[model samples]
Target: MTRNRLWYCGITLAVIAVGLASRRFPAMLPAAAGKYPGDVLWTMMVFFGLAVIWPRLGVMRLTVAALAISYAVEFSQLYQAPWINALRTHPLGHLVLGSTFNWPDLAAYTIGAVLAMLLELALRRFAA
Candidate 1:
């Protein structure tokens, strides 16, 4: 594979790994999330911004889809729908949506999407 592809894969894998590891072992992950919703939004925006600025090294549409899925999972957590949460407990679900969920997570995902678009525009300007 090309270096760009390798870098893309590495970034994607790293994000998945860190997200899953945090769920499985909260103690292992930093308590970086603050009570303030803005902080969470900012964090997500930054990460998604990276995806946009480095589109060639990442997959923008996939990243957006993943973020959408993440939001969906968070919303689904509200019902605590046994079947869904049970599915969430699995490695796959935990990695995708997370064990626990909250509506604010959706806002953060939106911030991420917007930031991604903005960053893409900025990168384009820089390139030009």
Candidate 2:
């Protein structure tokens, strides 16, 4: 594989490790940190997942798309429709759909997306 592709792969693995730790080992973190790290990194992982599929895509465009999908999922929590709630009943669903609407999540997602974009740009400029 190419150097850039390898870098993306390494970064994706790191994000997954941190995401799992954020959820699985919450006690290791500061109380104030709460779940924000996982929330932000999870959203950033989503962006990286997309980047893995389309690495040639512009960072700005990927950021916009990722932000749109992340916001849509967060806003959908407001509905709590039976189907959506049922979806949340499963572990994977719970992780993805979430249970309730929180305005702070939007901020978290924005931070995640911007950081993902910046990281991608940096990787392209410095690592490439």
The TM-score leader among the candidates is 2
Lowest lDDT sum, 10 consecutive residues, model 1, at: 34-43
Q: Write the per-residue lDDT of candidate 1 for residues 10-70, one digit (tens) a residue.
A: 5445544554454556665456753323323333444544454555544456356646655
* Model 2 lDDT, residue 123, Cα: 70
Alpha-carbon deviation at 82 in model 1, angstroms: 3.2
TM-score of each: 0.48, 0.88
Report the error of model 1 at residue 96, Å: 0.8
- Local distance difference test values of all predictions, in order: 0.53, 0.83
> What is the Cα-based TM-score of model 2?
0.88
Q: RMSD in angstroms, all models?
A: 6.6, 2.3
Model 2 Cα lDDT, one tens digit per residue, 1-128: 12356667778889979988889999999989888887788778888877777777777778998899889989989997798899999988988888898999899989999999888777768755
Q: Pick the lDDT winner.
A: 2
